[model samples]
Target: MTSNTEVFPVLETKRLVLREITKKDANSILDYLSDAEVMKYYGLDPFNSLDNALDEIAWYQSIYSNKTGIRWGITLKEQGVVIGSCGFHNTVSQHSRTEIGFELSKGQWGKGIAAEAVEAIINYGFKHMHLQRIEALIEPPNLSSQRLVEKIGFVREGLLRNYEFTRGKFDDLYMYSLLKQDLDKINSM
Candidate 1:
């Protein structure tokens, strides 16, 4: 397995580039993170200022430095502007597991951009991070997110009632996972 401290991986797909997010991207980050509809199921309130976006970017850096997780900004190859972000967090290296999260601008929805970016990261998690399982926790009401993971080959394990407290209340999340073997099976077929 590769060390998490190594250089951040820049992933690519046919139409997207998954690269590290820097402070300069704060404005683009805020563009989506501050939207109430986009933040609805994200477990955090909409960002109120550019400072909040900067802080969020800092958290992404801290997780990488701490060897806990990684997040990548999603950009189009043609535009090179960040439209979204995705990555694994709450990583437990010893257990070979981690959780996945992602968000995109409302205007970019239904374009299959997120799925492309997420698939690249999932492959990286298994091959580079040596993770056995990558999980996605989706709020029950977030059917779109649930469908996204399912379309990516994740199996819904169950629901974790009140699994997290955010936005001033406890929320139930559905546990969805894609094991490394599952990916192998999909690829081999």
Candidate 2:
């Protein structure tokens, strides 16, 4: 559903709490904002102040609360911390597909968390959201994200020429996709 109100709160996995972001989470946003490594893929530098984080959380909350998109604040069960965020962004109206995004703090790396989260969201997209296909537009240089998408059964569709602008320049993107029919086949087997 493109409406944000219907999906503000999303499904969570064993190790993560996927909840709608709120203005109260200024501190949580601040936590991930401090890490340049995590921010590297966020398309923006680390937050320079708490007020910037507050503004960001407010913006996310507004869009998510309206059901325009689905965004989750990823909290770890062990530490009860919001270490990252993930969600589905509807795009390319003619294709009827949505793009998946995720970012986690450096500390949470190498634990299969990204794949796990992607799996959960993918299932939700096909089952609950009734999406026909899911897509991931990963920058060509991000090896870790590329592998993570492949791990969850998304295939390399092709490189999208000058598809995205990052760090002030247009760049090619490696497209990955998982179709609903294929996902259903995997789930049924």
Per-candidate TM vs. native? 0.95, 0.85
lDDT per residue (tens digit) for residues 53-170 in model 1: 9999999998888889999999999888999999999999999999999999999999999888898998999999999999999998898898888888999999999889998999
Alpha-carbon lDDT, every model: 0.91, 0.75
Off by over 4 Å in 2: 1-7, 91-95, 184-189
At residue 97, give the lDDT of candidate 1: 99
| Superposition error at 29 for model 1 (Å) | 0.5
| 99: Cα error in model 1, Å | 0.3
Clashing pairs in 1: none
Against the correct fold, how does model 1 do in TM-score? 0.95
* Global lDDT of model 1: 0.91
Clashing pairs in 2: 3-67, 4-66, 4-67, 4-68, 5-67
